[model samples]
Target: MTADLPLRKIIHIDMDAFYAAVEQRDNPAYRGKPVVVGGRPDSRGVVATCSYEARKFGIRSAMASSQAYRLCPQAIFVKPRFEVYRDVSAAIRRIFSDYTELFEPLSLDEAYLDVTVVSRCRGSATLIAKEIKDKIRQQTGLTASTGVSYNKFLAKIASDLDKPDGLCLITPEQGPGFVERLPVGKFHGIGKATEKKMHELDIRSGLDLKRWPLSLLVQHFGKAGQHYYDIARGIDHRPVRNFRPSKSVGVEITYPEDLAEPNLILQQLIDLMGKALARLTAKQMTAHTLTVKIKYHDFVQITRSKTLPQAITGVEGFEAILADLLKDTEVGVKKVRLLGIALSSLHSPELLHYRQTDLFAFSMPSHFPN
Candidate 1:
């Protein structure tokens, strides 16, 4: 794995408060106020993004906007300007392309770039990150946090260590000790339920986590346990893969806590479906398979999926299909820690049915909005 490691300098860059920041930048009056970009609290909505000002009041993205309002009543909320954000992302991407072709965009707000042989940005990865942040702020009027490290895992985690215009670096020579001092929950792959399970096992930090045998971890958490073992040692070999001719397209996240409420969990699924659909449409592709993953409190994970008769690209339709699939509580109430949805068997956009066959009859008219 070490031999295959990317010798090229890889950097992860994530925009701070993407949607909210854009709103604040475009609308000068929204500055310094708690700005939320998502649906309203009155309509069973959650925050998609919020400004750092709002964060001071403990408001965060992916949380109920009502909760944000309760936390910071002075916050200004706005609907998502996805098109504007995409245009901005395109502009930022054009900057990265100036450096190298080996760019992998993780999201509209974040990307992984390999500047190995390229030297256009001056100095090393650290310097490049600083320049990139400056350029993004100068051109797009948005602050970005950056991570410079050998692998994707370290780069991603390092970027989050300091946020809202942060730049963090982790060298390969720094190695396992860096991870050892890391909190049990702070390890890249270890999330809420896994951390709790590790705590039960008397493994409360990265150092404490290392005491356990790798074989034992495999026995407990299955494949993920092996991943933990590797990451704890600062060894993540997963390469940055582009979505070139993809077999599948999907999005998912591991929550900070186990979701005990079924309704709340369903909402998470809807959100994931929305993101996956965005990716699908952006890529101009369709799917013939749908997979829903549930990671239980006990660290056991099960994925339920279905292969449709025809390729599907409709975001609302895909969500409906997922809701239908999830109607049966066969997985039971296990206090899920992670829920993800993915579509597979991808085909070209032309090969798939992407048009409105019956536009007026559709329940989600906005799905094909001009």
Candidate 2:
């Protein structure tokens, strides 16, 4: 099906150690040193990002700050300055706009750009990628790695082939062989759990995945099996949408000390919900579902959720739902390490009014984590 569509000239650009790099660029003292950005080493916070120097010491994002400290005792830990990062990201996007409007931002640090129709640089995606990288370096004083390919899947993969300040081009002729030789674990969107499942099925690489029949793959992996089949053949039909809608908004916090009391847990959830609601409102969106997540100190996790008959317009709409969702969990009986609230099935009230359609029939899970 994907083969019938015209080939796209896509480029994926990812900033190298974005948060840490911004910190280093702003503070001269942090240059050439192992820098960790996030919570303090003594706090229950996780590493948001770390410098390449810290990565050599086996430090990684999402690792416990204490563990990161243990790995690199000399690592300089600092809090994230999100406002500065957002400002830099806006600047980066302005650069992207100069080349093509068909760019989809995956995050503040990365994006997919479809330059198939762009006439700049003689329509050479490779040259455009190089120019983008150079412009980013010149504008932000930070390095970006870029990958140019005929599709988003290959483009994204190519971007990661080299690091820090790399520019890789994967031609149409090389795409299939590249996928065939690639490890399934290295494929985008295949998480560790999915990779483990694929390995147990003897699907160690793209070649092995390609050998499986689509029906059998579907039986094992459901709808995602089709995606695996397509990507294994170096085919991805997904477009680079410039105006992607918000699917969900949420916030979570990991506490320094576990809370055993129900009231304390509820209070923490209320605070998180408040933040999530504020984000939703800021986006001019409302949600029809509320989900509460609790993680025990032992890493055991459980979630409780409720769907309303109408859109949730304000905090008062979901405050009672929070307590109700908590009742379904072991919040009072278990010592909680993390608390989260997610508002899903989001819809812009103005859009709903314009379409004059009911939004209660749909529900989607929130993808963002605090």
Candidate 3:
């Protein structure tokens, strides 16, 4: 575990309404006016991103465009220009690379940088973040929000505290108190379902979560419980790696309407598995862990996973596993809105190395989120 080591400087940078901001920058009319970058208002489309001006009217990303229209009818809705976004993203990446070689891009508009050993800007992570933000504004005519801290979790959270051209810092002295005061739902990995579970147990804030015994959390939340235990105490050890190995690869489909027919659902699963297998083949990797995810009409989601003794490459071998997983779920009895298949514990033959001292090596528990 690296917990005993000295703290490192980590920074998380997220562009402010990246798509919408670009539109506003290119088109002068959108300045100080609400702008939305997404699908048409009349279609069954969702808002991808909206300007801060639009947010005042309660418009938000993922809200149906129709609802966003009802919230602010005059808001300008523009389709996404992914190519332009990619160009701007590359420009930002160049700026980041100048400060630190340790870059872990979370998405096109967000990334993490480890500047613990970086000498640029006099080795000040905060100064590096400011300079990066300034360079982005100068080059792309766009604004970004930045957060600086000793770990990834806090750095990410701080970035959102004051958004739209904001910069915030959470030092080691502030981390514990900041986490304690934060709402339980605000924890990075705790989704709506987990938040409901936490609330059911009278855990509404980080302080409340911290008071619970680690075993109790594990018993209630499975592997995710250990994650909750550590973050509540402001203990996250996840590193910023230049290359993050894909933990799992999968594809999922959400139907417009709930599916009731067993045969139809099986067909969907088969199609999904075919797509997953194709990707696995493309990567030249084999998977030892298979998981099937089901989301009911009411949005209740469950995953059934099975681990094989050895990795397999053929799609025919997964049929039995898929059937068994479906049989264990409530897909047939209840309406299903989504179905997915994921492959994990992957290994590439070319990447595997043998050692005489050990047959295989497992990372310490601290290597993961917990």
Candidate 4:
């Protein structure tokens, strides 16, 4: 037994239903409504995440708005305020910096902070977590849940045990036993799909999971199977990396007024595509996924994507592909309203760097028969 395994005190903090919380914080009128955030249901938009009130009516993020409408027609729907959310995320990240240099943000609303190596704040992780929660609520008018344990797995799982202004700390003594009794779905990194697979294997619970042979697990589940064996006994060795670089860099625009002209739309796409392609050059990355998002006047939205065989790393090449998609969309000036171009499958600047060429005034493609 490695008694000297560096004892870590990690805190996982997640804001309670972030976007909806912001709406409630800003508007008194929406406080009690079943707030659904994301694309509008009538516009063929998808749910980002619904408030608990909306969730009660069987709404969730990634579900179609029509389905959600069928479930709860009376729910209040709102678009995502990502700019405000990003600003709030920055403010909360600042608080983490005050505690330790070892902060790892999972998303806009969640992060894991390792406080074991701190020389100044000497006390229980629980106390620091409580103080952080207090500061967040005071500064942002938002509530967050905290989970503290020796490793990230235990810490993340512990945080979810109690949610929406909850704190849980799992000591080594309690960690293993807790994992044994945990429902398979509660394990970190276990998605809905994996939970179903585990169910088929008769791994109804963590105790049942612990009974699977290592070879069989590896045969069926590959590397994740090995990960399963370790967390079943509450073991995780991943470190917190805070200066994490962004993978893809792109820009988007929402039409204050819905556009209808084809030439006007294509011209706008050119400008937007120019900016996005320029960003790829600035970041010195290759984009594997080229996504063209079209939002209609009625607010119904559709996103089309093409993952290329070759990684695109320049303005001219990527923009050409984007223009092709735009031209083929066939949703002409009358119906088409907003266009957004995004590039993903990013290669780090470490892998590549900015390659610049002065070619902004490229000619428009000759495809549409006038």
Candidate 5:
């Protein structure tokens, strides 16, 4: 609606079926075959990601491994090799830095680049996106989909318009009409629950949402209503930040089979703590809170956390807290599907500046492991 605002050049780069593609690239046998990368089919595992081939049979990420197996019995299921993926992610990030320093990584395989002032490819954001796609293919032997737009929301939407080595763009002039035709559920922050609510209100698309009064939206969704209103009009002013400080670091694992034994769960916690602690130290951060999470076989998840007077800097301190939090849960009594330990209330030299900045604040000031 407003034409006076500065036009920012934003691009969203998403690797095409990242984890599944990596597996296929490294192992030639997986090529042209459906590959699911995550937990095994016999366990309580879920699909992390799947090849487009798997998608033909409706296999998707977060689906139960067993269900995926049932969908396509011939599909090859493999465990995740995060270390290899991490290496590839790092390599791609280095490639991103060559174009512009103003990029935010959403995950290992997805990132948003703000190249409003970038000079590479003669300052053409579209060309920049094309070059990036080419470089990723050359360097990592992987294909990525790129979306070029004036903001993150539209850019991300454009990226998904095409898949598996596709490039799409939505210009400022096209933003309004593009969003109007988009489904409410396809909007970035609108999840399944919100989509259901939108359906009840007949707010099925961006055009439908734009018709509702701001007051009505707020009455229905509280603070999130403002976001809905802004996005409906194709308004998103969020910046592409260069630095993202960690609020916490932790490690977690989902068991192949539900473990009901205290000793086994305890051992898993210990292992998780080691990885968590190592990550915390690697980031030069300290935590004052330790939280233990347990998910039972029935899918009920609970967390117990303790805030210490002093920051924990060693494994022994973390172990003590873990033991206490574990005791607070009914892990041994119920079959546990997943166990996780997290250290929060984090502090580090890198975060100190943001902590002191009055402009910055976390709505939820705690972090959890991915």
Candidate 6:
């Protein structure tokens, strides 16, 4: 089925250690040194991103800040300046606009561009990618890695093949063989748990996955099995969408001191929910589901959720629901270190008014506002 479709030229661009690079570029002293961005070493926060120098010392994003400190004691820890990063990201998007309007931004640091019909650089996807990389460097004083391929899946994989200012191309002729030799864990959507499950099933690489019958793969992995089956053959038909909507709005806080009092915990939840409601309102959307999460001091975590028939517009609308959800958890009986509230099943009121069933779609990263 995929063979009959026309080949599309896709390019994936990823900034190298984006946050840490921005910090280094802004501060000359931090250049060539290991820089960790996110939280202070003594705090309970985790590393958001780090410089390449820090990667050599076994530091990585999402590692505990204290653990990162233990790995590289000399690594400099700094808080993320999102405002500055957003500005730089906007500038990079402008550069993308010059090449093609079919670009889809995956995050502030990376995007997928469909330049299949673009005539820039004599319609060479590789040259277009190179020009975009050069423009980003000239404008932002930062480096980006680009991967060019016939599909999004392979292009994204190719982008990560080389790092810290590198460019790589994977042609249609090389896609199948390239995927065959790759490890199952290296596939983008295959995480640790799924990779382990695949290993237990004797599916250790792309070749192994390709050998599984569709019926057997679906029996084990359900709907995602089809994706695995397709990508193993170097096939992905998904297009690059320019406008992606926000899937959910959520906020969480990790307190410096654990809360054992029910009243205090309730107050904190209210405060967090208020922030999330404000974000929903800002986006002109309402949610039908509300969830409350609690992480106890010993790291036992639990969540309770409710789906309402009507959209939730404000915190007052769900105050009772929040209390009911909290009661279901052992919040007062346990020492709570984190409290989070998330609103999902979101829809735009304007769209709902017209009875549009297809809700707006976007990506919202989970935020830890502690």
The global C-alpha lDDT for each of the candidates, from Candidate 1 onward, is: 0.71, 0.77, 0.75, 0.69, 0.76, 0.77
Best by lDDT: 6
| Per-residue lDDT value at 42 in model 4 | 62
lDDT of 3 by residue, 184-237 (tens): 999887777678888999999999999989899999998888888888988888
What TM-score quantifies how close candidate 1 is to the native fold?
0.78
**Following a full C-alpha superposition, what root-mean-square deviation does model 5 have from the true structure?**
8.3
Residue range 1-370, candidate 5, lDDT tens digits: 3567677777887889988999999999999999998667775466778999999999986666778999999999997776677678777777776766776666667777877776666677777777778888999999998887778898888788889798887777788888899999999988766899999988999999999999999999999999889888888888887666777777666665688877656756765665566556544468988888899999899999888899776655455556777887787789998878899998885665422110100010011100
lDDT for each residue of candidate 2 in 231-330, tens digit (9 for 90 to 100): 9999888987765578788877766677787865665576566556655654457899888888998889998888888887655555577788888777
RMSD of each: 9.7, 8.7, 9.3, 14.1, 8.3, 9.0
Full candidate order by lDDT, most accurate first: 6, 2, 5, 3, 1, 4
Candidates ranked, most accurate by TM-score first: 1, 2, 5, 6, 3, 4
Cα lDDT tens digits, model 6, 1-370, are 2656777777888899988999999999999999998667765556778999999999986566778999999999987766677677767767776666675655567778877777767677777777777778899999998788888898888889999787888877789999999999999989776999999999999999999999999999999989999999999999987655778888777765677878667756765676566556544578999989899999899989999998886656565677888888887788998889999998876753421111111111111000
lDDT of 2: 0.77
Kindly report which residue pairs in candidate 5 clash with one another.
none
Question: Looking at candidate 3, what is the lDDT of residue 349?
Answer: 74
Q: How well does each candidate superpose onto the true structure, as a TM-score? A: 0.78, 0.77, 0.72, 0.70, 0.76, 0.75
Q: Any runs in candidate 4 off by more than 4 Å, and if so which?
A: 119-121, 245-370
Query: How far in Å is the alpha carbon of 277 misplaced in model 2?
Result: 11
Off by over 4 Å in 2: 1-3, 250-291, 294-328, 331-370
lDDT score at residue 322, model 1, on the 0-100 scale: 68
